[model samples]
Target: MDAMDVDYLNELLEQDVEIREKIKQQVSDLDKKVRVMVGILIKIHSTPTDTLPPLLDSVRPILRSCHDTSAALASLVPPNQFWRWKEMWSNSLRTAVYSAALVEYLSSGSLITLSQASEVLGIKEEWADRFSIAVEDYLHGLISLVNELSRLAVNAVTLGDYEAPLRISVFVKDIFAGFSMLNLKNDTLRRRFDSLKYDLKKIEEVVYDVSLRKLTDSTKSAVRK
Candidate 1:
């Protein structure tokens, strides 16, 4: 092309590269934070059910820090260009959503909604158009949560907490039923959803063992006596 056109194109390419680098750095930082949160939350498998509140509580500030980092990353993208650069931070954001969902599920016995995930990530209302968790990301996060809860069910049994496995089994099955109704079109998400049944099966096994052994009954009788 002409010299002037080439110069303009070159400038645009340089700007794009610069922005990509910044986004990469921000995403790296966010990934580290997500890892830290994951490390903390994964301990739930070994932790007692009653003491889980504090363990879940410990991640709040870190999640808030993640929110700050997420906001900074969002700032790096130009308005209306979030989808263009979304893949750069998609994995990290999904992990962050998983962490948030795990904390909520453990704290309460319920699933975290999309709006709640957005709140946990500190995506303010004004940033909705520019930055938000995709539905696929939220579903992926929930799938991760189900996987974790499956492991937690086995561990809870080891800890003599038979009730947890039953609770987890019901919750996960409910989630699985909900997922069954979705018309998932994304290949990766559909594949991930397919794996969820195995996790549910693991939880069911744990629940069955707990029931077969009458552990819940014994615990209840002991409490009643």
Candidate 2:
């Protein structure tokens, strides 16, 4: 190649690196904010309803900040490369956690639907078209919530909150059913879907065990009375 050609290629390469680095920093800050929200969600998940509003309130501003960063990233990255860039942001799991938390909080611990996720993310049709962002991004996050709820079920039962396991079992089963209906193409998402069955089974077992214990306790009480 000519010297000018070589220099041109080098300059392009440097610009590409700079762009990636800038995106990395932005995404890193976004992820940190997401992490704080996730931490609050963990506390909220275990604590009683009375403790939730303040924690959830704390998350809204952070979520808005995340939304702004996401919009900026979407604008900066090429359409073809946006999905890949989103994966690199590594926010899917936390985003899903946030969605799950918001839905549960709003509905008194019920799972949220896709439409509700749009509401939670404050994503409108116009904004989605403008930013080229997909609702599937939030839906993908819900997959992570299934895993979390399964673990939560086991822990809830252990903590003597048997009702929690029942709720989780029903919710996880619904989520798994919904996932089964989709024609998911992403390898990571598909694999995560496959793994959900294990969580479903674990939560089911906990529910069964809790039911059996309650049954036994009732029988003992009847026998004594």
Candidate 3:
């Protein structure tokens, strides 16, 4: 090729490299912040269920930082590079979803909607609507919550907190019913949704076991009368 063509190609390659490097740095920072939020959430999840309120209160600011950093990173990603970087930030969305749902469940024992997740992340619902990092991505996080809740239901029963399992069972069924109506084309989300049935079964089993134990005890008590 001619020298002019060679120089122009080299310049374009250099620009592309620079853009990638910048995006890498921003994604790295965003990933780090998200990991911290996830760590705190893990701690909260491990805590006794009754003690989660204060732990959630402590998590709010870190979660806010994660949201802010992720939004900044999203803005910095050039339109041409969005498809390239979108997967990299899915972790952030996952953590945001799990955290939001946990906070809502802890507060009210209910499933959180996408709009509620947007409010938790402190981002505009409109901004999250058309972007790859939108509330739809957070929907996957709800799947994670279902998995967690199933485990929590078992643990609650072991700890003699029978009511918690029933509550979790109902919430999980509600979430599963809602997910069934969505026309998800994203393969990753579709696969994740597929796992919800297993989580639903696990929670139902826990609830059944708890209810059976209650019935057995009541029957024995009546026999003693």
Candidate 4:
């Protein structure tokens, strides 16, 4: 309308553009690092269970870099505006959460909690209101982990580590049970949760195959004796 009003609006638009560009750059960098970590972590399918600890350890520094980049991105957003620009980094953040969770699971055979995920991403307690992993993102990451574990189950069988599949089966079932208790209203999250059953089935199949094979071998040994 008036020149003063138009100038003020233009200034606001310029600031928004500048902030968006910075956030995008950080998201892009984070996405690249996440891809690298995923590439490394996926090797768990072929890697022996005994060697996995070192493999996970290799990505520790990269995970720290991810935390640094996330902090930088958070700094660029105005306080309380995190949700507004969250979409730009949401996917990357979910993948980062998944990566951290995968590493923890591989190391200890347990799920990574939200606080641990936040700690992995280097989000401080004071910044919880401004920037943190939403419950939805954490659920999405766990779903991704289930999918990965299903694949790992099949690969573990091929690698002759039948025990890993059994462990994965139990872990996946536990995660699915946890999801069963939640009232997931988000469409994407609900859909992802639906897919968990298929992962569980695949893992269960691996466990069955491993069990049958072990039983057959035991019977053969008895017959020989």
Q: Which has the greatest lDDT?
A: 1
- Whole-model lDDT, candidate 3? 0.73
Model 4 per-residue lDDT at 79? 85
Q: Can you give the TM-score per candidate against the true fold? A: 0.94, 0.75, 0.80, 0.94
Give the lDDT of residue 57 in candidate 4. 91
Candidate 4: pairs in clash: none
Model 2 is weakest, by summed lDDT over 10 consecutive residues, at 124-133
Q: Predictions ranked by lDDT, top down?
A: 1, 4, 3, 2
lDDT of each: 0.88, 0.66, 0.73, 0.87
Write one digit per residue (lDDT tens) for candidate 1, span 117-215: 999888876765567788888899899989888899999989888899989988999999999999999999999999998998888888878777778
Q: What RMSD does model 2 have?
A: 4.2
Query: What is the TM-score (0 to 1) of candidate 2?
Result: 0.75
Residues 1-225, candidate 4, lDDT per residue (tens digit)?
A: 999999999999999999999988988999999999999998898898888888999888899987788688778888888688888888998999999999999888889999999998887776655567888999899999999989998998788776788788889989999999999999989999998989998888877887766633544576679
CA error at residue 36 for candidate 1, angstroms: 0.5
Best TM-score among the predictions, by candidate number: 1
- What is the Cα-based lDDT of residue 102 in candidate 4? 93
Give me the runs in candidate 4 sitting further than 4 Å from their true place: 215-225
Candidate 4, run of 10 with poorest lDDT: 214-223
Off by over 4 Å in 2: 90-110, 113-119, 122-140, 158-160, 215-225
The CA lDDT at 149 in model 4 is: 88
